[model samples]
Target: MATRIDLTLDCADARPLAAFWKTALGYVDEPPPAPFATREEWAAHFDPPEDDPDAADPAGGGAWLCDPDGVGPRLSILRVPEPKRAKNRLHMDIRVPGHGGPAERWERIGAESRRLVAAGGRVVTEFEGHHVVMADPEGNEFCVAAAPA
Candidate 1:
């Protein structure tokens, strides 16, 4: 069987970043495990003892997102004390369907770029008819590209 994978991102805050990613990738907040009413309720099952110095906060600061269509990998945004200091070694490319000719493909790419920018992403550079490099609200770099013909 093929293996499935999940992607994780460390951020100063998780909720907003998850929101931006959800907009960029067409993802939705993943629900709590079955039989659990909410994420907090599911987490309560693993709560640490009161005396433990490293006990997790009941109000956690992470967010989990998944593709609504169930084809893409899950995304986990974890809250961390440190901020992003450098460029990401790896990044995601948001691919839009490439139909018609060059002008049409570029139009589709541009449209997606504009949508992402409105959703808290910024354009880094544009490759004209090729692709547009963009950054999330936290400055994590990604790209908006056209899918294969």
Candidate 2:
């Protein structure tokens, strides 16, 4: 039988990234999330529909943000206790150039990355090969891998 699952990405600030990816991908975060002033207030009202107080806060589970109308996969930016270890275990690879190659797209992405850095994102590394690895403000490593040169 086939099964479906939500994709979870780990990050330190799920709140901001939720908004970022929303604009970046044309996806939408499900509404502003039912508000609560404190965790205890949240805990009392945010339980799942299954009816269990010992259960988790289903609405705010793991930093979730979703694709608009389920066009793409839902991105769940789960929080992690430690910083990112090495390269991405599952980085997003975008094939740019459409026809030009990695080298060709370098300048374009380079400028974009520069703006991103100026805006506070840090370039973990930019490779001559075909990829540029970067950390967002909250420090998640997603990459912009170009087409082969």
Per-model TM-score, in order, reads 0.89, 0.60
lDDT of 1 by residue, 13-128 (tens): 78899999999888999998899988777767885667843246543577889999999999998777678999999999999997789999999999999999999999999999
* Model 2 Cα lDDT, one tens digit per residue, 20-107: 5554446665444458654435546644556543355443434556666775667777655566666666666534453565456777
Model 1: residues >4 Å from true position, as ranges?
48-59
Report lDDT per candidate.
0.88, 0.61
Worst 10 residues of 2 by lDDT: 52-61
Backbone clash pairs for candidate 1 read none
In TM-score terms, which candidate is top?
1
Candidate 2 local lDDT, residue 48: 53
**Root-mean-square deviation per candidate:** 2.4, 6.1
lDDT score at residue 119, model 1, on the 0-100 scale: 96
